[model samples]
Target chain A: MNRTFRNMLLTLCTISLMAGLSWADTLKVGVQAPITGSYANEGQGIENGVRLLASQINAAGGVLGKQIEVIPCDDQGTAMAAAICAKDLVNKGVSMVIGSYTSTCAQAAQKTYFNAGVIQTSDGTADSLTENGYWTFLRNSFPNSAEGEFAANYMVNVKKYKRIVVLSDFSTYADGLGNATEAAIKKLGGNVVSRDKIKADSQNFTPVLTNVKSKNPDVIFFAGYYSDGGQLRAQQMALGIKADFIGGDANDNPDFIKLAGSAAEGAFIINVPSPDVLPYPIAKSFIADYQKTYGEMPPSIWGLMNIDGMRAIIHAMEQNKSFDTKKAVDYLHNLQTPIDGITGPIAFAKDGNRKGGAYVVKKIQADGTYFNEYVQ
Target chain B: MDIFLQQLANGLTIGSMFALVALGYTMVYGVMKLINFAHGDMVAASAFVGLTIYTQIMGQAASLAAVIVIFLLTAAVMACIGIILERVAYRPLREAPRLSAVVSALGASLVIQNGIMLIWGPRMKIFPELVPQVYWDFGGVVISLIQVIILALSLFLMVSLYLFVEKTRMGAAIRASSIDQDAARLMGINVNSIIMIIFIIGSSLGAVGGLFIGLYYRGITFNMGWQYGLYAFIAAIIGGIGNIPGAMLGGMLLGLFNAFIAGYISSTWADAFTFILLILILIVRPTGLLGERVAEKV
Candidate 1:
């Protein structure tokens, strides 16, 4: 054959192979959460956020000119169910996943995503989850790293707390908050006069209150969910122990106000910076669109992550010009866009966490509503 | 020393709450030879009732009459639930294999919690604190007022129950029924009524436990009953399966064991310690603190 013909044939062969290997034809992402179990109500909000974002992206000519398909996987809010969902999503060739809202579920699926070489971002903040890797997982921008300094900084520096009593459920998730806040308290030259660990599901914290009372701490720092935090506050006030009950992101739930009733007033939390509370211009439009479609405000914790994740994925696909895993990931690492992302035009850190991150302070209002008080 | 005593005093109050709930398990199992696995949900149900009443009675100051009325209402309403559950669930399967009844009880429990969720909603509602957490200290041992009352109330119930069982005619009938249902039936005692009564009493006790649980803990939920219920059931079994006094002893032992273990060792091992203690007791005593020696028949 002539040299020119030989080179042309070789070029044609390479181009054909490249065309065949391009994964743009099937742009696939998986969104996972519990459609059942304890967190189902909250999970619905998360699913809605991501789904709506994906829909918006698809409406905008789809990712890389191919239709973006988001596969919904049910974690059932349990570890085992989440692992099963992870395995299925991996098998379906999903290059990216947003999933498994609770820490326990996230833990179960982390290994699966890690092994499958799929990137995942979860709404859960258990201390151990994203500690190991940058490739395998990302949290909703906020990691447990914030809870330590955030809680203490708010109470000690912002709220000017001095004598504090720390209450913890000692759960896999809240333990981080507890350890963090306690250390922060000590670091600020303030002391933890009392510390008590309760069963995670404990309804009564009165006995602990007595121990707390002896310490006479001005603030009662509780690291757990709304149910326990609010209940502890209500019970303490009913007894008139009068310590300002403080907590982490768990307190940023309306359920705390409902549970604490009149006692919920002035209770403080270090929390996720809300889509509603963000000073960024995108929050207003996002909230309006969310309320218009879903008939409610965006959910407190898990919702924004999924929305931001979908935006990230779609943006990555657009930048890569293909939906192939390697290209999409590389795009994710490099692509930057001013998306009106729910958690404030989120930028990822080198470790793929949200840049300019996490809420430092929130307050529970009189009517059982939570509002962000400070964001940096 | 002060902190140590104070924590013990604090834990004792929690132990008292455990005892109050454990009584229902012990009493129900003592006569019926059934686990009454639903006893925990029964606690949830009664708490719901109190919570509903608390909502109604909000903005009002605490009164002795109001307290008595609420307690009586809780007992009566829960007694009815207990009786109905027993009639529909237990009596039909009295002659059948025991496992079926236990399974049915579990179903009933699941149904009850779900029913509450349906009737109410999935969101956990906080019941108003029934006990005012007034603190009273003796030297260094600080006792919350709720703890004092739970200790007093549980003791009052226990002493009265012991006296009634040991000294009253109906109590004799109950004891007779517990010992031998067939014998009690042959002696013209309505064994069915006795069983119904047992259910009512056990559930009423659970109802009070539930009410006190609200005042003591201040948070009530659809599933709050299970944690305490599991511990109560374990206490019942470890204290010789169906012995009343044994259940009480077992609860105290378990509580003390947990507190000491958490204090002495890693707090994480407290659960393991309690379970290990149960297994050890099961091996050594088989029956427990007040449990009767049952001769294994060859």
Candidate 2:
């Protein structure tokens, strides 16, 4: 009797194991972000956005009726760590990966994702990221060069500034935008009075500002992160230079106005349209839900981009009726209609760069508030 | 000529800050013969302490009285921290091999830096604008009122420090201890207290430098100490590491060189060129410009 009972238990266990193998109904998505280190705030913001998207998707019966699982891997804001994260996620058999705010980390993971045949939707904005012809790599954010051109055009054509001086931190992102803006300004028949580069950790800009004052430019275009941008704005005012300060997405943070204080007033910033500017019900609902869950407004409008990226992949999976990376890549590449993004309608160009991504021109108000001045 | 004057003002302003921080390095090395690598980190800590006092405690009021209070409180807190660090980290290793003490100093620097990072997080904070900004334009050469105050304050502090080191009984005790620790102890001098006082004085000067940096830059970061510390160390070495006045001179000269290079050449080359000039100076005069020629007493 004991032998018969043991054999029956073994038979039941074998059948359950076979069922588990055949009926796997979970999709693993990898989240690569610098969840710690210098860019931890940005990484946390991106991670929160991705998690919000996943929860919303899961609550509404999920994609293809399979539960979505997020495998978080902190890239620590470095390329080497990003590459390792991509490899680790690939080894975990994740269908796709989303991540990485900085271009350096995204570019580092490019070949790894490409070789592993995983679709990587990154927010990195370097133009060279897409120029490499990686079929699996698609960027959700607009290129820095595009932002640079937009800034130059806005200053010269719209604001009607003729004499422009450029300052950059010489990081890949800053230099790219600075050089591109300089080129575009000259292309549009505007004068570039002087160009200067500041080191990353420099706190004092008096000598540089003094030199800039000597040139007497009408508009000073700064292309660095908000920390230095704010410092420069304050120093410019302190030195009595009357040039208008303008910068790229790096200066979009609220901290810019606080640091620059009264000096930040009238300064223009070009970045992706913030969530506050999004008028669509979809965007509104996402914001409300995100705030309800996370206890804050989305860290930045880039949170919307991350949501749209996740939606694009989930929508593709739903269309394909299976979790296939190849089909998702194909769907993103040969898209006939635009995917509704909180930022705007998201569609990929031939190079897998998002086509409908728009730059919003924002001006800092006198009372340290931002108002949308223009959108393109 | 206007540009030269403007650069000169810039050099003097920056030089004063460097000199203030270099004094700390010079004093500690003078007494202990140990490079307190953590000296720079102390400056950074003082900045954060001053920031916390302004924002959290003082409710972000931009008054001169608040600034004075914060400066004094920050200096006092930093002095206590310096004393504790010396007692715990340096004093135990006083008799150990100098390499062990050096390693301990590096470890102490990491602890302080990371400890501050953990408390404040890694965001760059804008220092409160207590002093109203006013520029003083002399024809084409523009200088800020803050620049004048910074220069005056730095010179006053350096002079006061020089007097304290040269004139008082405690000053004589400190000088005696630095010259011959065992002999000073045998002659009834409280060698430990003298060293403690040295740390206190050095750290207080560092606190002042940190406060000025926050005011001048209007922004401070957790890792700012590393850059400022490196520059101050170079300044101390260039002025003769153990010589107090040498440190002040070294800092001012380094600041002048930096400003001139940035004004005339490229800002990118300012740091590289400064180091290159230092190497050249060292090659020419191994004992530095004001370094004394003291024979081995042993």
Q: Evaluated with DockQ, which candidate comes out highest?
A: 2
Clashes of each: 2, 0
Highest TM-score, which number? Answer: 2
Query: Which ranges in model 2 have alpha carbons more than 4 Å from their true place?
Result: A1-40, A58-97, B294-298
lDDT by residue for model 2 (A110-177), tens: 88889988888887777888999998887888888788788888988998987889998866667878
lDDT by residue (A274-309, candidate 1, tens digit) is 566677666677778889999988657567776677
Could you tell me the lDDT of residue A84 within candidate 2? 92
Chain B TM-score in each of the candidates:
0.93, 0.97
How many clashes show up in model 1?
2
Question: What lDDT tens digits, residue by residue, belong to model 2 across residues B1-298?
Answer: 8778888988999899999999999998998999999999999999999999988889988777898899899999999999999998999999999999999999999999988888987666777677777787788777777788899999999999999989999989988988889999999999899999999999999999999998888777777898999999999989988899999999999999998898889889999998998898789777677888677679
Give Cα-based local distance difference scores for all models.
0.73, 0.85
Docking class of 2: acceptable
- TM agreement with the true structure for every prediction: 0.81, 0.90
